[model samples]
Target: MNFPVQQAQGPDRIGQQTAVEQSRAVAEVQAAIYVARQFPRDVGRSRSAMQAACGSMALADKAFYEFPRAGGKVTGSTIHLAKTLAQTWGNIQYGVSEMRRDDEYRQSEMQAWAWDVEANTRHVLTFVVPHAKFVKGKVEALLDLRDIYENNANNGARRLREAIFAVIPDFFIDEAEELCRETLNKGDGKPIEQRVEGAIKVFQQLGINADRLEQKLGRTRDQWSGADIAQLLITHKSLQRREIAVEEAFPQARITGAEITSKNGGGRKQGPPDDDPWAGQPTK
Candidate 1:
């Protein structure tokens, strides 16, 4: 006897589109979580982790941007690798498929369900989020800097960015805690919330919203009990006020709270991420 393959019902195209859009949002959030896990800036030896983080971002790049450009033939392997890395490192597996399928809506919906469930699992892994967040942010910074360098052709800025990128994955993860402590003592640091918020704003201004990363952070907070958004706010502030380097700020704060909650939970909590999710996809 052979088991029959399952397929999504196709009576409603409109509904299917809506579902697909929603699922994509969840997938984006999961991609962010994977980024966080793959890069832990608060540790000593995390080159491997940094590489993993880059891999996830590359997947996001392919799925949302590259695949569409390539006539939709970039393959789902990128997404699948991203989700696997996130689950393996982040302990946050919001619906990721290893098998390839056609229904984009199903993949997206699975991600959405996983996001809901994983958000509640934060209590089990609060300590890991902060470090992971730093790594993820560094990866973003590096990527952004690369784009800036590529587009502007400024030798000075390119050199600076390249130097920063080269030392990033190792420096922050190794010295984040100490760096944050020093900055905080200076009473001139910018809070983590502000930094993250500023970072997001800048990206959005540049037509690159890091929706998934922010969503994953939010989900982590939802799941964890001891997680504190204030810690992130404080960290970012400490860096800015003290004029601390990104190398320092990147690892000091955890993404767990800031990624998910309001600025230090000071204001109203943010709503769920519904914009453009895209975490894991199966390979056919």
Candidate 2:
């Protein structure tokens, strides 16, 4: 077996593809075994074994199916050997991918649970009390308050808990109390992007960023004219309705936030005051 081993920066997505092309016949047989026979599930109870088999099968099938007319048995054997080596060397990559996928699936389940909790929380709270919108200024204030509560060593757990309680509405607090409490006890993970990405996944699950929102909001007008303002109002109304539905559906999740309407609020009432649209705009 004369397989070319790729330098391990990460899992060999492109390199594996090249190997597959060079050994198509053997690879097709291996892929057939994987997809048709369910070799991974049947091989062993351990997940590592399943991943190894799956990865090997992928390499094998790609090689066998994409081989040139002249490529022979030696090429097939080489692909098989490379895949076997990858099973050992790329275990961490496989495990991390599997784990992240599993986490996403679990997050979906949690979002459903959060939605149910929100429905109940909103029903109970809306009947008893009314709360105003937390606009941009409020959002900034809350973020600052949260930072203080979270960062302060002298703030103590009780004070921090109180701060969180004050920041969220009673309607939201009822459902999110447990979640916030958990966050207070166990701090959020590092890498802001990961946490935000996880939040976006939940946002996706709730149909917040769905084509539904896009269709309801639609596209903005070409100019910052009255037509654009009307469209903005229409989108704002649509989003307002969604906010209500979201609150009534998922109280635990923080879906409500300030949306950017004007890029420069104080600077300009409308788009460039000049008639020339590209006056200040740059050339490519």
Candidate 3:
């Protein structure tokens, strides 16, 4: 009986495959550049479309992120906003790609790029994302595939946002951000009181209580205004994206049982345990 033998993939075969892939990628990019040059974007129409999109309360809600930084909250446009601008502005190629994975280092190298095919301008950022998470003031290795992927994706998304902005005009981004803030402040035509209540419910689902939110804002829940609610909405988006942790957004001090009893008139309410991931925070 004759048996068929399987041939091993040689170095030459690997090299040829790499070359073919590179050639294909070059061709795709060139084709895009040609198309972009042929049909340039209309600046006026693009700007108008971007403004219309930013004026939407739904899009505005996800268009920005805010996080505590250096004793103050830092606000900025998010990946969602960047992507929207790229689409509306036209003739842009933008993406993030995982270039390599090193098991020994437990990290992945990612490449993010945005190109203005029409203008032949491009911005690229390459960085490494560790397969780890900070838990309880310690770095913990990620063992699950899903967790590692999420970790990389979260970091990559931020870098991709940067790359997209680098290619886009700074003035355009600023204008869109302003429009989004105005839309967020205006809200979905709900009364301020109703909106506050709705925002509280949303935060509650994320393990943040009214007390914590009040503390974060340095005011009572009743005192929260439309502007304050708008800021909280941006912070909520940041937390949901994993760009900032709950502890960082709303820090609470540790209260002893005695302290709790004293503060609550001897009826201590149950709180998260010391070991809880979202416990032990104090707001500024």
Candidate 4:
């Protein structure tokens, strides 16, 4: 059940591994499950459970499976404990695939939004095609524009929403309108440092181990890249989507926001309908 040797910061990825190395990696995967199963009592520490499982798996993969492994039999797993480990690993592997699929779905969903955020830079550079001298200026301009986009997306979608309503072709207006209304803006994220901390905290909520993720990346909270943050948010969104879908598909599973709010006693306190802000919003 022991973890594989690791660096002070993280596991050292061996670029190319021999057959022995591959066998050991599989061994480590099983061993991780063995250690992780001992954490079944982690009721409030779901992240810790995930950490033990994923960290082991990630460490094993990082150390030996990143590249083509030498051909060798998957070492012993016929024993009871080994069999259990193998089974747990399969379950965890499937969960990992689900996580990956969720991330990909969200990435594709945001493709157009990302283009919108960065498109102004391209508009400014339209006349500067194939020029190396403008590189520095272009880079700075893009950074400046991106900062502006960040500010707008965080503060409000007013500018971006208006721009979309204006520039989007007539044919796509309906679809684009919905996207504009729902896209990333209106405090979807915080500063990178704060977001990193929030992202780490969210691992437990998502049943992912923060310690395991940290070990996988070989870095602490602040070390996560922009891409990492995107993945975390996307994964979280994916989980939410699945939960919503499940609830909708099954009547018994339905959990309304108002119900949850009422139970928690922290959401908007119900009052007379006349006081509602949306009460004045015309249905049209």
Better of 1 and 4 by TM-score: 4
lDDT of 4 by residue, 25-142 (tens): 7897666566546543332253333234333322221111011113321221111222222233222221100111122222111111111221221111111111111232263322
Query: Which has the better TM-score: candidate 2, or candidate 3?
Result: 3
Better by lDDT, candidate 2 or 1: 1
TM-score of candidate 3 on Cα atoms, chains taken together: 0.79
Deviation of model 4 at 250, angstroms: 26
Cα error of candidate 2 at position 234, Å: 28
Name the top lDDT candidate.
Answer: 3
Residue 204 accuracy (lDDT) in model 4:
69
Decoy 4 TM-score against native: 0.21
Tell me how candidate 4 scores on lDDT.
0.35
Each candidate: RMSD: 24.7, 28.3, 7.2, 26.9
Error of 1 at 38 (Å): 46
- Local lDDT at 281 for model 2: 85
Q: Which pairs of residues clash in candidate 3, taking residues 3 or more apart in a chain or in different chains?
A: 251-281, 251-282, 251-283, 252-281, 252-282, 253-281
Tens-place lDDT per residue, model 2, 198-222, is 4345456555543233333353222
Tell me each candidate's TM-score.
0.17, 0.15, 0.79, 0.21
- Model 2's alpha-carbon lDDT is 0.31
* Whole-model Cα lDDT of every candidate shown, in order: 0.35, 0.31, 0.88, 0.35
Query: Compared to the true structure, candidate 1 yields what TM-score?
Result: 0.17
Q: Which parts of model 1 are misplaced by more than 4 Å?
A: 1-188, 191-193, 216-284
Give the best candidate by TM-score. 3
